[model samples]
Target chain A: MNVGELIERLNRIGALRYEDWRAWVIEESGNSNPTREDVNAAALAWLKDKADGSIWLDPEEEQMLGEFLENVVPKHFDGSVVDALAFLERYGPEIASKDVADLKTYLNSPTGLAMIEKFNGHTGEQIGEMSHFFQQESNQDLSGYQVLRELEGPESVGNTSGSLLAAVTGIMPQQPDTAASAAPAPEAAHAQSAPPALMA
Target chain B: MQELPLAQTHELELIVDRRNRAVLLHRGPELEDYLWAQFDPEHNGLTLFTEKGEPRNLGLAIPKSFSDKLARASTLKLISVSERLHAGRPRQISLLQTTEAFS
Candidate 1:
């Protein structure tokens, strides 16, 4: 799908990540990118579409996200968010509150936080794997959940909270002889559904 | 501690719910809103905060009755109670897992 279509889908599913957008833009425009400007403008237009649009991120929510990103990105996951100010300032002025609130709410919601907490518990090798995965051209646009799904492959995808926890917990440093096609651990295989995606 | 009014209360919700599972969401965020559950299970609890290094007045304590379900995530239920019933007070939160998560 084209970028606009991609954005619409991401927005609808509440899976949009600023890092993904910036990565896409940087790759397309070759630096001196206008992603933030365009995003700010689009956000203004989206808010103008409806004062209470569900997708906008207000300052309060932005601060929450800034804190979240401070902890997660730049290390476990690589790409963008140099500092909190640069992180928070990307949106346009006249930004309505809480359009962003919805985003932050969903982003930090319990399940998301739970899964993120699992990712946070990764070993140095796991961290390396995650960083490498995000930096890949094919993986840049995928959400953290999507990356996990891919790593786990379709066979072991876990849907429930227990299995989700197991799904994440089940991830370990694969033995060199471990086949990528081999099934996930018994706990992972026990989970039947997929959990939600997280923002970056 | 003496009881006092909280600056922000009753702000979290479970946006998605299955019988045994639910997704936790932080709602009506203020500039101070941010969750620091990173050191949890080690620090012994996941705390949401407003100001950095300060967790005052941001009560997201889960009710013990429901917190047990969470211990069962290994067993695989969602570990949820009713968000409305449990999240109404800062003094507690409740996550009841039923071994039916992902159902």
Candidate 2:
């Protein structure tokens, strides 16, 4: 999309909050905050390049663009490109893979391609839940439970304690009489003591 | 007792002689994490290793019970247990000639 059109869309999404769109422009371009005139000039240049089809995206650039359109735009922009780009810097990695895959699939569908101009939408909470479920299933294990049991002793501390600690505690109880047991007793003088008389 | 950095992944080699009833445990850098996970019991998703270097991915749901047993066990005794568990069994090659003869 042309820069002006892109910016206008972002503005509609509530991306452009201030009277001057300079902050949003700078963020989108990854450039230092520029003056209004500078932003206008950059925006015009970006638009011109797009119109001429001179903007060739490398693999990294393409991936970034795909991520931004599928994740950043739908989630952050009320409809605004400005707010979306800003949010992208922070929450980009947290984007769900499934959302991106779904977006690609939809975009390739005949119906989707027919109305490609109206394809902007968010996957919302469903994507988040899917990601959480996948992560949980992959990492489910018993080591933590075992560790907890060991730490809390064999009294069935339930699943809350670390297994390593439980095992250690179960194996190594403190010796209460270690000091007393270590002390040597003095030998009595056997010869000095008189022998007891035998009973009739 | 010194911790190795996660950047390095090491492979471990274990030898098992089922006929001789012997097991040898070998450790290198990569196997450190695996060993720690197995013995620690607190490490979730840890896999147990057989003397033949094959992983027994049996998810023992109750690690606490296993840890209790391990706690009372000496290092040598634990090694012996690991060896016995991993010892190879005779494979049945044919109906007429049983592999139990080799065992």
lDDT of 1 by residue, A104-123 (tens): 45336675444334333332
Compose the digit string of candidate 2's lDDT tens values, residues A87-135. 3222222332324334445435664343332222131212112132322
Q: DockQ for the candidate 1 complex?
A: 0.02
User: Best-fitting candidate, measured by TM-score?
Assistant: 1
Error of 2 at B74 (Å): 59
Superposition error at A50 for model 1 (Å): 27
Error of model 1, residue B46, in angstroms: 5.8
- Model 2 has fnat of 0.00
Superposed Cα deviation of residue A127, candidate 2 (Å): 27
TM-score of each: 0.23, 0.18
